[model samples]
Each structure stands twice: as C-alpha cells, then as structure tokens.
Target: MVRHWWLILIACWSFSLSADEVTDLYESRIEVATQSRDDRQDALREAFSSVLIKVSGQRDVLERPEVSRQLSQATNYLVQYSYVTERQQLYLRAQFDEQRIEELLRRANASYWSARRPNIIFWIAQETQRGARLIGRDADSEIVPAMRRQAHQRGLPISFPLLDLTDLSNLSASDVWGRFERPVQEASRRYPSDGLVMVRVQEGDNGQGYLAQWTLIVGNTRRSGQVDTEDLNGIGMAVVDSVTDRVAAEYAVSYSETEASEFTIRIINLQDLESVLLVESLLRRLASVEQATLARYHQGTAEFRLQLIGDMRRALQALELDNRMQRVEDPWSVTASPVLEYRWLR
Candidate 1:
C-alpha cells in the first residue's frame, strides 16, 4: 500500500457514523473451515491478523517485530472459540482479548485508528461492454459486492451515492470519470461524510485484466492510485488497501494519550444519571484521562475535572472513535471563552 503519513490535528465538524454502531469493531470473528486441524490454526491466525490491521490502522502491523512474534501463539489470545455446523460444513467462531490487543499496540506505539472511523462516500464509474456507467446506492454491479467484501475484511466503512434525482443532477459518471473536483465534492457534501472517494474502472486490453483508478479527498488533502487486476474482485481488494492505508495514515495517529494536565470539561445533552455515568465511565477509561471526577450536573449539562496524561487531541481521537461523545462544533455561549464541551452522541 502506498502511504504519506499526515497526522490529523482536527476532528471533523460533524460525523454521520455513531459510536454505538462501531462498538463491536474490536471483536474479530471469522468463519473457519473444519476440513483439517491445520485449517483451525490458520483460521486463528487470520482472525488475529484482521484484528491487528483494524486495531492498528496499519496493514502490515501484524508483520511488526513484536506483533509477528506473537502469531505463533495466536490462539493464546483467543478468549473463546466454538464450532457450529451449517449446510454440511462446520464453522469456527473465535473471540480474542480486546484489552490485550490494545496493550500490545500502546506498547508498540502503533497508530491506533479508532473504530470511530471517517465516513467515506464512494463515487465509482465502471465501464461495461455497452458503456461506462456510475454505480449508485441501488446498484447490483459487480464492483459493489466486491468492494463490500474487501471493506468488511478491512473493517472499513464505505457508502455509495444515491444516484437519485439530486445526485444525478449534481454529478454524473463523466464527472467522476473525469475527476471533476468541485462537482464531485459538492455532490458528496449531501452525505454526513468527512471525505470523498472517486473510483473509475475500465476494461483493460482484452484477456489481460481490468484497471481501477481511484482518488480520495479529505479536506485539503487528496491522494490517488490505480490497480490492474484480472478481475473486479482483485481490483476491489486493492482499492480497500489503498484507501485504508491513506486514511489510516492520516487518522490512525501513533501518539498515545498521557496524563499530565488537568482541565474542567462541560458536557451537554445528558438527560439523566445514566448518561452522566456513561460519559464519566467513557472518560475514565481513556489512557489519557488519569482521573475524571464529576464536578456537578445542572439542567441537563454536566461538568467534570479531568487529569490527562496527554493533550485533548489524542484523547478526543480515542473518544470519537468510540462515537459516544464528540466535540461540540459551535458552543453557543455569552462569554468570549467557553469551557471545553462535548455533545453526547447516544
């Protein structure tokens, strides 16, 4: 995968994908064939490998010296495993220790891409025997399923344009194929997304393979790449690798939270004691927050004193990844300086 490390310094103003939707990301479970004992071992390694990639936002993280040394003991991390028979085949489902994985990453200083990832809207153009067409939200095209499978493997979340009246009116297949920035970016603004990805696919020389070209846009930063494969499936996998590598590089920050400073934080939208306690638990769990003590709660707003190991940036990244709470975009206050505030996303 091609990469250009760009440490993200700011959070998106708005996020479409919520925290509850991503809570299950740490649990890696894959179906394993029961054909042989070796298959079980291989499956365990594969599942752990997936966990490593998703957790670290580094495709080659499993190959890291410390991480690679543990693969032989892949099953050692497996918290539980089970066998289920379905349609003449037995499937093995495995669960690994989430805390152990996080501890390993922190020790390695790996770029931990929180499960609360950016929402990417894909505008893919495909060339067929008859013509070039845009893949839409309702598309049953080959690239859609292939991309979905690859995305699932990478634990990357992606969405397609609706191609409805609005999308078609604002942008077209030619716009994406031609890489028209203003129109494509404008079209993507309709979604609750942080970035825009455009993909163009065409048939290569007969019997050779297919060619897939792609570009990703996150604010002012943009990156593009291409892949040549025998079929669309291979191309889709390549697309996932390319996109995740770039996104991970930008957002999968390597800096771990540290405890050094203390600050008072204000939270809004806490409806009850449950919400207050939930936010408190979330804050205290972060490695950055050395201590989080509730200050007070009045009129649906809550306050806390946080002793942080690091700055708010890393802590925000981790908390945002969980999707339970997010920084307030615009805090309406009468004073010139307002307290640091986050909105509950639940």
Candidate 2:
C-alpha cells in the first residue's frame, strides 16, 4: 500500500476532519453514479480516469499509450467498491490501488503531482440572455453551482470573489474579461491564492457552442488557453484542467522518492501532552513522512526525528493543511536550527 493509504486511515480515525474534508486530495478513490451495475465496466474506466487526472494533474493522461491500455483492464486495478442508492440512483464508490497506479506511472516516466495544490481564485464572466455578468461568491446565479461542481470533480481548490464594495471599487467584469492580471491581482489581495484563473465565456460564432477565453496568473506569470464546449457544465472544468496541467508540470515530483531519509525538525510553543501528540501525529500521518519519533521535549518545544520519503515540497504542502505548521518568515528571531512555527488555534 502507498503511504497515502495509511494517512487516509489515520485522518479518518483520529482527526476531527474526515479524509474528504481535507483540501489535499490524498485518496485514490472516486464515486460514479449509474442506473445499474450494467455500467460497472464503463464506471470503472471513468473512475480510474478521474483519479488519474486528479493525481497526475494531466487532462490528457488517459490518452497515454500505457494508460489507454490499462483502461481496458481497469477492473484489474480495483481494490474494492461499495454500492449505495441515493435519490433513486445507484452510486459506486470505488477505491483503486495507488501503489499499482504509481508503479504504472513510473513505468511511463510520468511524475506524480503533489496533493498540495495552489488555491485558484476564479474570475468568470458569463454572457446570458439578459447580459454579461461576473460570477461572484454570492451571486445566487446559475453558473456558480455548475462551476463549483466541476471544481469538486477535478479536485481543484477554486474560489470566487465576494464582489463586495471593496472588490467593486477595484475591478469589474471587463477587467477580468480583458485578461488583466495587474489590477485584478491587486483587487484579489484578500483572497490569498497561489494563482488566479480568469475566464471569459460567451456564445460561439455558430451561436450554439460556448466560446471561451482564459488565462492563468501566478506571480507575474500567465498561461492562456481556450475551450469550446456545447455544454456549460464542463467549461470551467476544462479551463481548470488545462491550467493545472501547466502548474503540475512545474511542481510535480518523482514517485520513486519513497526512500526514507533521516530528518530532524523543531516545534516551538507546545504547551501540553495533547499539543505534543497532535504535533507528532500531524507529521507522522503525512505521506511524505514515513514515521516520526519525538527525540525530546523541553521548554515549550518538541524535537522530532523523522524518517521521510517523498519530496520536500510535498511534506511542506501536507504541513500547510489546517495551519498545522508554518515556515518561519522573520529573518532575525529565527533559530539557527530548522524550526517549524506553530501555535494552538484555540
């Protein structure tokens, strides 16, 4: 089993948050709705495709030669599944073997994307029968739910602006539609995302398909792409998938980084046993952290020596969840030794 499986079990059993509740997409599982088991094989392929897209951050991963071959034998990789009926519809929750899939990806020479993805602040412009409008956080509009569903499916952490007076004072739909990142990012200060995706959607030249233009902005950088879809439901998903492929290309690491390395990190301001246990569990449960041992605890601090696998970026990304550990930013007061800045959020 991959180390992520163990982390999933521990998060489910010990943490207050469920595995699904975490923004980090750790589980290699996906649920598909079907009318009957007759669609099981197709569902198997779709589920595998979905999880693969989420893990590899490649929208075209299914088209890879080896991946395409495996899709024909998708059922062979299924670890287990359960059937549930909801609202007169049957849903299959399937779990695939992550280790096997990682091996397959390795054989294909594809790197594995870390779960610590950047939050994307989506600025979407929609042209409706009435007029064009921006999709805000609380617009009570039709497109918001559709786009959100797509975000959930792709396992992309996406958010929309509140479009309040503060935002209105700075930007308009025209700014978003124009693909202007300077003024847009200036307005997006409160949203604190690693990047921004600006989408402009209108009727196509044929007046049937959706004509869309998009750009992704990250730290003075921009990547642009377009998608023409007959349906509105998949438009946002298509844009997100394209930009994420680029982001993954930049950040993904090798899956073979499972060799354990000894590492020691210090935690400051731990007040009690609960804090110590919580701190240790946070590190030990990370997929990148093979195991963690408390070497000693003294003077409101704890020192842990850990056996680590996976990339350092991944370990840092796991620590970002729930503000468990934060990097020391101040240059002067920081210790010469590596210290993880943490505080109980009570």
Candidate 3:
C-alpha cells in the first residue's frame, strides 16, 4: 500500500514538472461579473496587478510609481485573453507578454522571482469541537480549497500529505498540531519537495475567528507565524501569503540598472550530454543570467560561464532554489578561479 501511494505521488510529481516547465509566468486570471466591455477592462487591470505581485514576489509591487503608471495601459501588454468558467464563475484569463512585464519590472527596479520555484509540502491539522483532524490531498475541508486558491494566486507550488495507511502509521494529527518538527520531518521524507510547512488551525481566543499558526522550514531557515481571521479561508490564505513572502524574500533577485557581469560556475558529476544540456538550460532560464555558455568540459565535470544581470552572489542564490544542483563545499575553494561549485544530482 505504501508503495502504491508512493508511485502515485511520483507520477503526480512528474506531471507537475512538465506543467511547470511550460507555464507562462506573466499569465493571470481575474474573476468578473459579466462580459461587458467595462468589466473586461477592469478585469485586465486587476489581472495585471496580480501578475506584478506574483512575478516580482513583492506584495506592494503595484504601489511602485513606475509599475502603477503602466496599470492603466495593462491591455497593451496582453498577448492573448479568453473567458473561462470554473465552478459556475466567469474569469478572464489573460496572457501578457513576459518580456514586456519583465522590462517594466526592470525599469521599476523591482524584485524578480523566476518561474523555477520551490515545491513545499504542507501538513495541516485542524482542531474543532469534534476534535483534531489532518487535512490531506483529498480532505473535505474548506482550508484545502482556500490554501490552493492562495497558492495559485501567488504562483506557489504546494502539495499535501497523502495520508495513506503508511502516513497514518507514521504521523498523527496530534503530532502536527503540537508542532513537532522531528516527526513531521520524518513523515515528510517520503515526498520529494524543496520545503516543508506545518500548520495548526483552531478557534481564536475571541471564539469568533480562526487562528492558524504555521512553521515553514526551507533549507537552513525556519520561519513561524500566526494568522487570525474570521473564517477558515482567511486563515488559510493569510498563512500561504506569509509563507510566500518569506520564501520569495530568499529566492527573488532584485533587478539592478547596471551592466551585465561575467560569473563562472563548476558543476561535477555530469555523466552525459543530456545533463550538460539541462545544466546550461537551467542557468539560461534564470532571470539573473543574461546568457550562459560552456567554458570547459572534462571527464564528468563541466564549467559554465554566465553573463548575469545581477551580482554573482544573487545569481548563485537563485540557482540554489533548484534541488537538482547540490552545492559542493571545498575548503580550498577560491573566488578567482571558480566562484561557485555544485554537483549535478540525477
């Protein structure tokens, strides 16, 4: 049974990778009341505002004068648009030109979080008059939809525990509600993800609202916070927003109005031509890297020189967001020869 569940998760992860690779970063959707001309115009403006927040990873990006100035002309950047209905609600799906939006951000000197984002696994425990219960992928709870909605709005990739027999045997709702990192992490080992998040939801002190306390663990950083709201959806959305802000702060690169600089990186354990192509593609996809070229190649080792729009430190930081590249620490490492070193994980 555990093996079956693991296979399903692996399949899902594979499908999501294909989706993420082709996903448009500048596309957004906004709910609208009718198909009137005024409503379409208003929806496009609001949709662009959402895109700015998602792409820049800055909640206040629309508040920037340069960015706000372009909001009135949001339709000028739209490459395509369509109307879609979901759950009987109409939405305007707008696909804006990615280059134009990035250029606007560059002019605004805003932060840019690339489409290559961290996939976080969530473990949520909700307490009520009945008792405590865990929310899984198939859980019939309002928090699930609320969390998914918020994560999608912010362009975050999030997943929930399978809560199969194997999961139930390893973890309990009490364990998550108590914020026990050890057990939560132990249970999370089966899922392939970049980060882990645990949330505990209960009635607020005022007895009329919900309180969600969450802990996020990504790399060596740990962030914890609490959100109080009048309903479950608010608590879920607020928690996701808080988590996105923290993750984006670490991964997003600030656009600088400066000339591009060169940086060299060494990656070992590249055993095939496909790995080499993938490495170069990943480097080239980063917003910080203007261009990436293979400098040299040896037996199972390759060095790539990158023309970066940002500093070397920030470029390396952005590359670290992808889990396939594992940083290799060398005691004798020097900046003059190789600025960064990593091992390509299969």
Which 10-residue window of candidate 2 scores lowest in summed lDDT?
18-27
What TM-scores do the predictions have? 0.76, 0.70, 0.87
Alpha-carbon shift of residue 271 in model 1 (angstroms): 5.6
Error in Å for residue 116 of model 3: 0.5
Worst 10-residue lDDT window, candidate 1: 1-10
lDDT of 3: 0.85
lDDT leader: 3
Ranking by TM-score: 3, 1, 2
The numbered model that scores best in TM-score is 3
The residue-level lDDT of candidate 1 at 304 comes to: 85
Residues 1-346 of candidate 1 have per-residue lDDT tens digits of 1111111211112224452234555556567656478988987888788878877877878767788888778887888877777787777667788878877887766656656577777899898767678998779877788877777667777888889999889977889998888999999888877788899998888658999889999645699999888988888788888998887776665645433677888899999766776677666656456678777788889988887655666566556655457777655665754468888877
**Can you list the residue pairs that collide in candidate 1?**
19-323, 258-309, 258-310, 259-308, 259-309, 260-308, 260-309
Q: Candidate 1 regions off by >4 Å?
A: 1-20, 29-35, 85-90, 128-131, 189-192, 204-207, 219-221, 253-264, 269-275, 281-301, 305-311, 314-339, 342-346
Clashing pairs in 2: none
